[model samples]
Target: MTMEPIGTWHGVTTDELGCVTHLELQDNRLAGEIPPELGSLSSLVRLELTQNWLSGGIPAELGNLKNLFSLSLSINQLTGPIPAKLGGLSRLFTLYLGFNQLTGEIPPELGNLTNLNGLFLAHNDLTGHIPGSIGNLEGLEFLALQGNMLGGEVPPELGRLADLRHLSLANNRLTGRIPSTIGNLEKLLDLELEHNMLGGEIPPELGNLANLRSFSTRGNDFVGCIPAGLRTAALNDLAELGLSYCT
Candidate 1:
């Protein structure tokens, strides 16, 4: 068998109609931007290019793939907003686009991907609020949106996602009270909401998150005491529930 391209020039060897099922180019010194032509591969399922030096925006043509399941492009230098066309990927499960220079709002169109599981868009320059459409993701498990400039209230619709387990929304400029509907997320285990401008009472409904183990909200503008139920109920792991600057 001929030697396969292993390190930097891996994707360069990918041929059209090569029937590749899994393409993992993560952390192999792959530099430069992703080729837009790769979208022609209709058979691709898992495509991982994380932890590389890849730059430039993700190609909008990637939406052409109707069978892609996992798409990982994290820890790269990719810039520009996520393409709304990516919403065409209905079967996608995991989407990792963190640690980049991506800007603009979280696309509401992404909510069309009802099969999505892990949605990682943290450590970028993204702005705007969490889209209410995200509640349409009935299968989402992990959602990370920290270290950005996202504003606006936590969409109450997010509480509709019964499968959500991890949610991170710290270090942003978000305002408004914590949506009481969040208490409906019984599967949530880790919830982070620190360093924001949110105010108003902590919703009593959150006390219903019995699966919640870690909750943080430091340096916020919240007023009134902690939710009575949270201070005394199943969520009373006070040490693990770091709170600060509540009015």
Candidate 2:
């Protein structure tokens, strides 16, 4: 018996009905803005156009892809605000729009993606408070909003993401104390809050994250000693802990 590879071969994938289901063109040196006509592919389930020179705003028409579950447009020259319409893709689980020139506050409408598992909007021009509505994504495992201009207190609602494995809010203008509720993320492996304006004492409750491999709160305004529990126990064994900047 011969073994076969899983999923489509590459250029495109179609279903039994010949409807496009997956498309990938990463690092193809592709240029120009994404064609709004792409939203016409009603049956499309996955789309990738990463690491290209694509520019202009994300098409509002993409919200029409009811079947789409993954969309990656990272590392492009994309500018303007992310379409609030994207929140309408009810089936979406992974959405990557990082490393672009995207501007404006993250649409509160994105909280509609209750099925999301990974949400990456880092390295953009995003500003304003992190939406509390993001807490609705109970299935989310990865959330990255670093390297932006976002400012405000870390919403306590983020603590509701019980499934989060990686959480990064580094290199932003965020301020305020660390919410102790984050200690609830028992599955967390990497937690980065460095290079922000956040200030306060380290929360001892973070010691609950025994599964962490990398944790950092450096380059912030935090004062006092690292929690006694954090200096020893399982956390001390992490591959990287950036508390050296704590005062």
Candidate 3:
């Protein structure tokens, strides 16, 4: 049965031959929990269910889709912990679960996704330390865990992500000194760690970030003079430097 172009509730649709590979139900005002039967679609590669009113925990059955490469469930009212079963999607390259009401610690199993290039979990009610295993995503270029209740020191293992360009951990309960190893992100452009409990002097090693364009550490418990390199022409090229509320 071919899907009608008009509108439908559950947003269920299928190809003319009844074979499904890609399912897009985004912005259709979809409600209710996603059907766990969707896991039976072994060939499904992309699932877009964003911008809807869907509520309930993501089904663990989704982990059965071994060929699935992209899964986007952002901008919805989804709650509950992200299923650790999702880590079984070995081919997944992009995972967007941001802008939801998801709580609990991010599953460390996600670190097993070595092929993931983008992982967004921001704007949620998630709490717990940022997983150090996240550093295992060697291919990841964008990592956003901001706007949550996560607390603890910034993991130095994150320095292992040499390909990372944008890293935001702002507006959380994070504390402890900024890891000096952050200088390892040579490709980093935007780095935000603002509005947290982070203290101690800003690391001088951050001056080594020659490509950094915007850096913020404001609204924290940081003390001591700003790194001298931050005042140099090298870092002056930054578009923004937030140091307000620091001593």
Candidate 4:
């Protein structure tokens, strides 16, 4: 568990020897809820249970793992809201909990993980506004929260995450304008916001993004010119922009 394990999911049969540090149980027939006893493994570092039939909300005991780094529980039948205590894992780097039946707004406690690099919470029935506390994740590079019923404005606090390279908020019921503060994301490479109810000028401030390579507004009600800085930059010069009209 101290040693980092590699390789993709191979189902429940993956070796669980005490000395065997890494294990992946993705895309398998392993049914039933995640075992609470599994949290007793003090050495486990990465646990991926994606693309399975595993049901039930994540066990609160998972917060007991101090050494855990990567935890992916995406594409499953799990229900109920995310465990708020998950924010206690200061060492966590990547957390994926997409494509589930989980409801409720994202826990603000997640902002406590300053070391997190990737965070995914898409395709669920989640409601309420995105938490502004997420702006505290300075190390966050990838953020995905598409295909949900999430509403409310994108938090301007998120603009503080200079390390963010990818941002996706597509297919939600979100309203309000894209924040001008988004101009702060100088390293962002991709920004996706399709099928939402976003309006107001596409903040020209977004043009400040020097690395922006992809931007889309397929079904939103955005009105205004593309940011001049982005339009003139070489990054957008070769980029394929996506836009559509829905009257």
Candidate 5:
């Protein structure tokens, strides 16, 4: 219960915390680590230590916080890896390290945070592949690398995330097929490639995802049937369609 040391004590008021610039200590049960002098708070901009119980390993001096833009260390109990100097926080736009216990890989320098729009590394224990420099994060719009233990395939350069909208590589250990340039993510809406080891068939150009809403490929190794434009009506905002244990 003696946490102090965030910055400028002696009577508070940089809005009750001294020279503050948005530092939300989420779920405040804050534990340890994460104080490399808070990277000298070079005018921080949104740093929320999420759902506390924090452990160590995320302070590569926070890349000297060149004006951070939303960095939430998700549900803590942190582990290693993931600090490729936080890609030097080039004005990061929301980077939440999901449900912690993090491991290696996934840091192709976080694709140099091209004004990233939400990139949460799901669950954790991440492995390799998936970082074709994350297709240089073309203004990414919510991409959770589901569960984790990620394998290859699926990165048809993430179809160049033209403002992607929720694309989870479910479970993990991904395999081949499914990337017909992912129908160019026409603003995709929830497309989790169910438990991995994927196989051929299913990409009828993802029925040109007319803003698909939740489309899982079930336990993969797909074989056929289901791609009738993802069962017509241009996916009519389909609500959770998992191709039950594909043939």
Candidate 6:
């Protein structure tokens, strides 16, 4: 007989003062709405409950975790808009709320998280333009906003993230030309913008992103020859290139 995947929730940790600091319960077979009382864990530093069967709107009370550094609740059946109150997380480093049934536009209040390093909100029902305020995150390294219903032009402000390594805005309803500003992310490693309505020639400035490895603009209205800089194999050791259906 096959053994059941271990579902015991056992990574709880506490500080010397007896305050709960970490609670990890990924794949724990949890169900029902998250408890609002969890917000009372005033000393909590990290809380993760990914890959479970939880549903219902995310409790706004979670925003009360003033000391939280990381929060992961992906791969669940959660719904409703992300809590704008979460913008108050001044010390947050990584925030993962992807692969849920969340709706509504991402709250601009999230821009207040200047200490954020990674932000993942992909594969949801989110709509509206990419928030320009996100450019305020000077230390951000990873940003994934793919597989949503967001529209509008790619914000030029995104180019401001100098430390960003992975940037994906793929499989959305975004329009307009690829911004030249993106080339400024010299640290970018993987960039995907496939299956959108974006047009115009791929910016030649993109060739300047020496660190780009996986690049795709495969399904759009773009016209013009692929830039010569992209044809060179040595300059950008790309592991994957999806230039189909757009050239």
Give me the overall lDDT of model 5. 0.80
Q: Candidate 4: worst 10 consecutive residues by lDDT?
A: 238-247
lDDT per residue, candidate 6, 55-88, as tens digits?
9998999999999999999999999999999999
Of candidate 5, the 10-residue stretch with the lowest lDDT total is 237-246
Q: What is the C-alpha lDDT of each candidate?
A: 0.84, 0.87, 0.86, 0.82, 0.80, 0.87
Runs of candidate 6 exceeding 4 Å displacement: 1-9, 231-247
TM-score of model 3 relative to the true fold? 0.87
lDDT of 3 by residue, 1-247 (tens): 6465422425444556555768888998989998899899887888999999999999999999998899999999999999999998999999999999999999999999999999999999999999999999999999999999999899999999999999999999998999999988989988888899998877878767878777776677766656644543333312234342223
List runs of model 1 lying over 4 Å from the truth: 1-18, 231-247
lDDT measured at residue 207 in model 4 versus the true structure, 0 to 100: 69
Write model 1 residue lDDT over 109-182, tens digit each, in one string.
99999999999999999998889999999999999999999999889999999999999999999999999999
Candidate numbers, best lDDT first, in rank order: 2, 6, 3, 1, 4, 5
What candidate 4 gets wrong by more than 4 Å, as runs, is 1-21, 232-247
lDDT of 2 by residue, 67-138 (tens): 999999999999999899999998999999999999999998999999999999999999999999999899
Question: Can you list the residue pairs that collide in candidate 1?
Answer: 224-247
TM, every model:
0.88, 0.89, 0.87, 0.85, 0.35, 0.89
Order the candidate numbers by TM-score, best to worst: 6, 2, 1, 3, 4, 5
**Candidate 6 lDDT score at position 200:** 82
Cα lDDT tens digits, model 5, 69-100, are 98999999899888888887999898999999
Ten contiguous residues with the weakest lDDT in model 6: 237-246
